[model samples]
Structures are given as C-alpha cells and as structure tokens.
Target: MRISELKKKGLESLKGKWGKAVSLMLLLFLINVILPYIVEVIGSGGFVQWFDQEGTPLWSDIFGTVLSIVLIPLTIATTWFYLDLVRKGNPEITEVFAIYKDGKTSLKLIGGSILQAIFIFLWSLLLIIPGIIKSIAYSQLFFLLRDHPQYTILEAITESRKRMNGLKWKYFLMNLSFIGWGFLCLFTVGIGLLWLIPYIGTTLAAFYDELIVLQEDEQPIEG
Candidate 1:
C-alpha cells in the first residue's frame, strides 16, 4: 500500500483509541526514557561512588546492557500491542509489559537483538549503505517474532529478510512520512512523543498488516 493510504487507515484505526494508545506510550516512556535518565543521573552524580571508587565505566556498561535487553522486547511488545490494536481495535495497556511475564521469550528477544546489532555493525564496517540496507532488511524481525513466536530468532531474521525483499524502500518512505510529526514532537519538548510514538506505532502496524495481505494474495493458488 501507498504511504497516504497507510496514514489514512492508521489514523482511522486510532481515531477513538487515543486513550489506550497514549497509555501504551507512557509505558514506553518508563521503558525507554525514565529508566535510562535515572541511570545516567545516578552514574554522573556519584550515586554509584559510595560503593566503589571507580564505577562509572562499570555503571555505563550495566545500564547499557540493561537498556538493550529491556528495549529490544519492549519495542517488539509495543509493535505487537499496536498490531493487536489494529487487528482487534483494542488491547490492554498491560500488554506492553507482557514480555516480563515470559522469561524464555524475553531471552530470545535479547538474543535476537544482540545478533541483529552485531550483524548491522559488521555490515556498517564495510559501508554505510550496506548497513542501512541490512537494518531495513531485518526491520520485520520483531513483528514476525511476535506473530510467529514458535520461530527461532534466526528463522525470524531470515523470514524478515525474505518478506522485505524489494519493499524496504517503500517501507522507508512510509516511515519518512512521519518525519514532520517527529520534529513537531521536538517543538513540544518531547511531550508530543507521548502522542506521536503511538501514532507511528499504529501506522507501522497497519503497514505490516497490508504487507501480510499482499503477500498472501501473491501466493500460488491451491488446487
């Protein structure tokens, strides 16, 4: 589907669902923003020094790893929640925290994230363009992981690459359409992101839904 169509339908999906969406957004703040900010404050303000004379580097790595683990699944969970919101029109705000309830799934998410990061970094070492392309190629990893939880991380990564073949540029444009909204969020001093994040999430989910349907349609007819 085209970018305009995705935006129109995505807005329609979110029209009466702002409350739930914003709630999900706030949960995201706890996951993505507040936790890291608190970590940084503690590290920079000598809070960790009471325990150790030299803790800054250790604290940095600790928080960095913690945030990576938290962020990877939280991101997938956000997309999963929004995908549900698109498909069924509603999902519980607690859905965002569902990852914590399943330890195995959370581990797999962490593993997948580390693998993707390593691959992207290695590719980036070769050239910027290849890194960008690989990043987009793996863009569907989280969605597929959520939808097909039975799939291994490698399976999801492979399938995402296959599914995104020839469509990454279109997907990139769909994301580009949100640049204006993102900048507007900056003007509001990041408060606007409480709204814009979910807006983009729902729209991206809708776009994924469209891709699913398109893929199904292109499949060979059964006798």
Candidate 2:
C-alpha cells in the first residue's frame, strides 16, 4: 500500500479505539520521557544529554551506544505491543509491560539490539550514507524479534536485513509521510505527540503486516 493509504487506513482503524491508543502512547511517554525527567530533576540531564556533555568524537562516540541500549528495549516493547493490537484488534494498555514479564527473551532482545547499534555505528564510520542504509536494513529487527523471540541476536538481525531487502524505499517513504505531523508535535510542545505517536506507530505496524502478508502470498505452496 502507498504511505497515504496506510496512514488513512491506520487512523480509520483507530477511530473508536482512542482510549487504548492514548493509553499505549502514555505508557511509552513515561518510559522515554518521565524516566528521564526524574533523573534530570535529581541529577544531571538524563541518559542522552548527560552523555552529550562529554567531549567524545561523534563517530566513535558512545552517545548513540548508550542511548541505543536504553531505547532499544522500549522500541521492542512498543513494537510488540502494537503488533499485538495489529493482530488481535484490541488494545490492552498492559501490553506495554509485557516485556518485563519475560526474562530470557528480554535478554536476547537486548543482545540483538546492541549488535544492531554496533553494526550501524561501524558502518557509519565509513560514511553516513552507509549508516543510514544500515539503519533501514535493520529497521525491522524488533518486529521480527516479536514473533520469533526464539531467534538469536545474529539471526534476528540477519532476518530483518532479509525482510527489508528491496523494500527499504517503501518504508522510507512511509516514514517520510509523517514529517509534517512530527513538526506539529514539536510545535505543540509535545501535546500533539499523544495522537501522532500512535498514528505513525500503527501505520508502520500496518506496513509490516502488509509486507508479511505479501511474502506469505508469494511463497510456493507446500505439497
């Protein structure tokens, strides 16, 4: 589907489910924002900012390294929660906490996430373009991890790279379609984010779903 169609259908699907949608965004907001705020009030700026204060070189800098470690799990949890909604058509706020309930899978996800950051960072040293390409390459890592937590870190990253083959531009355009909403969220001092977050999220989830379904249809049938 085109990016516009995905966003249109995604919001249409969200019409009556505003309650769950808001709740899901709120949960994510707390982890990414409130936790940082708490640290900022009690000490220096939180994770990302605190690292920025140091004079590390941008290329080898551990800023993204440290930041990725923090953000990746949140990313995983958010992806899994929304993918569940995508599958079940019901949004349970508790889905946000579902990641914590797992010990083994969580560890594996963290490992996979760090490797993702490392590979991207290494590629980035050669040229920023390669880094961006690698970013798109691994874009589906967490989503793949969601259904296949059994996948090892290497396997998860490998499969995400495979899943994204020939489809990066579509995903790129899909994300590009949200640029206006992103700026609007900034203008609102983030008030717009509550809606914008779920809007973009579900659309991406929809994109992933569309890809998975397309791949399934293309597979040679079993005997």
Number of the predicted model whose lDDT against the real structure is largest: 1
Task: Give Cα distance to truth, residue 44, candidate 2, Å.
Answer: 9.1
**Backbone atom clashes (below 3 Å) for every candidate:** 0, 0
Give the residue spans of candidate 2 off by over 4 A.
39-71, 216-223
Q: Report the C-alpha lDDT of model 1 over 1-223, residue by residue, as the tens digit.
A: 6788877777788878889888778877786767775677676765555355444467767877777776777777778888887786577777777778998898898899889889899999999999999999988788877777878888878878878888899888888888998888889999998888887887888888888536634432221
Q: Which tens-of-lDDT digit does each residue in 107-179 have in candidate 2?
A: 7778877788899999999999999889998887787667666666777677777778888888888888888
Q: Model 1: residues >4 Å from true position, as ranges?
A: 39-57, 216-223
Question: What is the RMSD, in Å, between candidate 1 and the native fold over all Cα?
Answer: 4.2
Per-residue lDDT of 52 in model 1: 58
Instruction: In candidate 1, list every pair of residues with a backbone clash.
Output: none
**Which candidate ranks first by TM-score, i.e. highest?**
1
lDDT of 1 at 47: 53
